[model samples]
Target: MASCSNSNELLSELVCSVCLELFQDAATLECGHSFCKSCLDRKWDSEKNSICPKCRALISERKYMRNNVLSNMADRAREMQIKGETNEKTQIKPSDLSQRAEVGNTDHFCKEHSEKLKLFCKEDETPICYTCVDSLKHCGHNFIPLHDAVSIYKEKLTEAKFPLETHLNEIEELQEKQMQRISEVNDQTKAMELHIKSEFATLHAFLQNKEQQLIQKLREEKERTLKEMEENLRCIKEFSDTIQTQMHDIQSWLEQNDALHILQNITAIENLLTRSQKNFIKSSPKLVKHGITLGVYKGPLQYGIWKEMLSVINPGLTSITFDPNTAHPNLELCEDFTRVKNSGIYQRPLTDSPEQFSLCACVLGLEAFTTGRHYWEVEVGQNNSVWDVGVTQASSNRRGNIQISPKNGYWTVSLRQGILYTASDSACEALSAKPQKMGVYLDYEGGQVSFYDAGDMVHLYTFTCEFNEKLHPYFYPGLKGSAPLKLFHLCL
Candidate 1:
């Protein structure tokens, strides 16, 4: 009897503290404590920090060494204790112990009737024997075969796990996409930074301050976007972990063959599924990284700055004059070649030159610009019934009837009858008012041509295109207009 008690004490020592079960596949931690390998692993995985379950020591490295000696001792102790043998040095293999554990106990019997519990009592929420069904204690309770009850509960658990599995998959996919987006964001930010730096490096000295402002703004935007993406990733991971734990619990419940145990807390399980469904709907995480834009930094950026610089620098307009050689027969130029008008009759001794306009009463500027910025003004009579003033490409047609459009390498604003119209591929757009003193500004490298009312410098219209050839200032004094088109004094 004393030996049996000692044997029980030895068996207790072999039991793992975490699971309170005889150690199976035992593992030793760095802290010199032992536990069932699966128990230790589950504990560590569920916790944020890894620590020894017995000693409470923080585990720096997760190395689980299999304790072969302890495992063999635990198997021998469990086998001898179960078989009521008091042999301390008895040899028992792990497989022998596993086979003994696989053998299940007999079905439980009702204490009062001493009969097998084969029926489930729905009202009492427990298994009862056949004799107990007619007893006054269970007189009015509903009952079903134990097998049927197990089947029903297991089916319900199985059905509930499907949505949880799908929800977990979606969250995992979102996590992968979010990680990819983070990498892409970094690449895009670096590329944009280089582009901005190169652009600002070419700008004037005064723009150094503006360059710093833009860089700072870009950094702030990147920080904000990354923060949002990371937060979304965290949320997705947290929800994914929650679903995984719930599904694990449900699977365990479904694997149970015992009717009474499987049906226990059935209402709580249904409530859990309901909560998961609601949370799945509400906890949808999205990756939100808005694209950064240059805003005012784009589209006629340099031109706008140059306009601002004009006030401080006080740079004057460019000096430009009409090329009389390119004038039509009926167009007469002033002695200074600064003004032109369409005379009623054609001049004698007709000269048909390639540079001359044969049909339209138009004249080209003496200067041909292929690069840099140029701004010139032309004065038209306030009540001029018909006139055209803008820039045209040097290669454009100057002979016969021609369409004054961008396709023909011409960009002009004209007045027909009494309304002002700007030419385009689709159709001509009418302007609210005509500019008597018209300002035509051309940015060769910037790919922009803008017109303004020279009187107040109010912007009128602009055209953007890629320039591949030399450009010339064009003028047309309508045949029916009373006033001539005259050039303004030059300023540089």
Candidate 2:
């Protein structure tokens, strides 16, 4: 028994009875025998015996105790190993340290969930914990093991850094370009402002000049009209005085009852009366013959210089006519010739029937004439089939030849020049003569007629006479002579 007891002691010392190896977590069994803590626990469980394995002594089931000293020693060794690994890792360069840190952080705890982030998303390359992996939000998403994913993402991050840096550099370049564009736009805006200001200044000056010219013209016309009115009044008063004198002389002779003296006085009074009557008739008709007058001729006229024939006549000679065969033939008539609403009809030698006849006049200084296009309507008539006649100006000849077709009611004329012409288009014809006074055959209503350039509108000029022949109408320069010209037939 002593020898067996010795052998058992030796065996206990040689091997851990619980672990079956050396006594790594050595502890004493309740029988005062020693064994490893894990091995004894295992033996107790397997045997269903609460007795010491060697001593055969009964042991209480509740007396199992952990060997804290042995556990502490093992914990210390594990700590030393972890520390050695950590120190070795720290020896790596900062760049390598960053790679290690990235892998560590990806498997780190989530800030929001307070759970380990382990599963890595291949798409976004982010780590997710078990909670996130099972979540419906990330269902069907591509994922990989955390460790493997971390290594791959680290390499990707390293590769992406170069492109990211280049992108940042490109961003700076674009910023510079944007700044340059802004500066250029500012400069262009300033230049545009200056140009607009210059144009406005020029326009203002032009308007001022035009205003002055119009004012001057108005003043001159007013003065001339007043003077002519006074002269007409004087002529009317003289005729009245002559009539009164003749009547008084006749009354005195009748009251005397002296036959011889009465006869002599009557004869003398008759002679004086006849002479006075003739003079009065001539002067009175002149007073009643004045017609309406328009302002100066400021528009382009093919021929004829515009002249003020009457005090009220503004600047342009509106119309004129001459014919010897008519009752009122050989007359050169002007509207308001004496400035008394009376017109003057002067008889003159008739012109020979020349091969060609022409008439022209101007409506110069007319404000209605602008840089754009203008239109005019004219009517001409004679006793025979009128040949081709046209209206034209010196500046431009494109809008000249307006024909007055017999089929067309009236001829339309345009003042624009240099327009292209086809077979259907009209060509401008130049006027042969510039006539303040125009000549027409007396076989019919013989007269040259034109429009006056009243700044506000166009006034028609007509020449009519009592004749017995059929009159043919002619229009100088036709636009689309197929259509009747719009007539400004308002009589003043």
Candidate 3:
């Protein structure tokens, strides 16, 4: 900073006043004013009197002589300014070295006592002078040599660093997953936007209202999903920032070696480290399940959304509860019609209710599927026991043992001995995979019923038949089955 100021001051002296440039063919006029020889000559040629161009000072003669002494001074000033700048940047000032050296001067005396910091008080975690070691403040504290204390703390610091670094790596991995989720959201929203616009184009002139409605729904979903994800991302970012701050503090503390200051701050660092080691990897952003309902776009434009909804949209997931009036004696109906488990002994029929299942340990959902596409999922938790689950004709036989097949008005699948069995008139096809959550999709018009592994949408089986009777979702918690089957939470 000082070098720049001096350079400007020197340059001002070297420059010719009239031209504002370095002296060229430099000469002095009789008025003791310096100007370039050509400038003086141009003034004499253009003017009627021998007057200075800058102040209009009268000169004794029209002739001007070259000042060799003043010219040399100007040349030297420019050279010195350049060298001064170069040296200022490359060479360290004495005061700067002194200032920097003061910070790392641990080997020196204590700031308070002005005596050598030879002893380290372990309890306080700081270096102290001999006077401090003997003082009442450190009466019961254990003291060690400065060098030994530093060595011990360094090892401890190294031990702490390994786990923090591992946690840092996990935080990075979580950040990466967060980004992937963001990209998935972006991709899904883009596809939805394009699909909506294209579908609207097909119905261009007739259904502008419907088009705007669908597009508006798309915008709402985009905003809602992104808002949730951004909030999650923000949480992860806040956690990351906290980890970084703690890391920096620990590093600074480790480098300082000031036992007194270290003692004052060590507790915070330890607490931070303990917190960081646990729960370092937070919940990253994930796409909301059933975030948007398709009814907004689907009611008016059925065909366009139906096929797409099959894969992307969770449509018409009706909330289904078991009907106690239809439960068999052996089957225990849980509260809220969500779960069922089999008991060993079968109780006698409570009443002559026609809706009750008299023979089998099977039950029916409260609502019957009369029309439209309906979807629902049941949690068929892990077990090797026999269990039956699917849709059944509402008026199907509930009296005696019957083959659970389409011909018997039961379009269903059974799990027996770790194998999946779909019943038909021909024979049951053995399924390879066992699903925890069973998804059932019923299309009354298509006259089709299909099942899936709800978690991944892996197809299990499809039953083809013409439905003339009202259908109800069915379940058979077999006598030998141990685990309870639960209906998944579906929208109202």
lDDT of 2: 0.36
Question: Quick one: how many clashes does candidate 3 have?
Answer: 4
CA lDDT, every prediction?
0.73, 0.36, 0.67
lDDT by residue for model 3 over 1-492, one digit each (tens)? 566445444444455655555677788877667887877887688888987664456787675789887688766654555577435543333233323233234345554443567888888877788767756678899998877776776667667777777767777777777777777777766765665676566546656765777688678877887788777778777777777777776687678855645544556666755765654455433333333333332222333333344653444544578888888877776667788877755644655776788777788888888777677788887663677889899878877676787878898888777777787633344545678777777778757677766756555677767888799989987765568788853421
Arrange candidates by TM-score, highest first: which order? 1, 3, 2
List TM-scores for all candidates, in order: 0.42, 0.24, 0.41
Candidate 2 lDDT by residue in tens digits, 86-144: 23322222223223233233225543333556566655445666656655567788877
In model 3, which regions exceed 4 Å deviation?
1-107, 111-113, 193-207, 252-492
For model 1, the stretches where C-alpha displacement exceeds 4 angstroms are: 1-116, 123-126, 129-132, 135-141, 294-492
Please count the clashing residue pairs in each candidate, in the order shown.
2, 32, 4
Quick one: ranking by lDDT, best first?
Answer: 1, 3, 2
The candidate 1 region of ten consecutive residues with least summed lDDT is: 97-106
Clash number for model 2?
A: 32
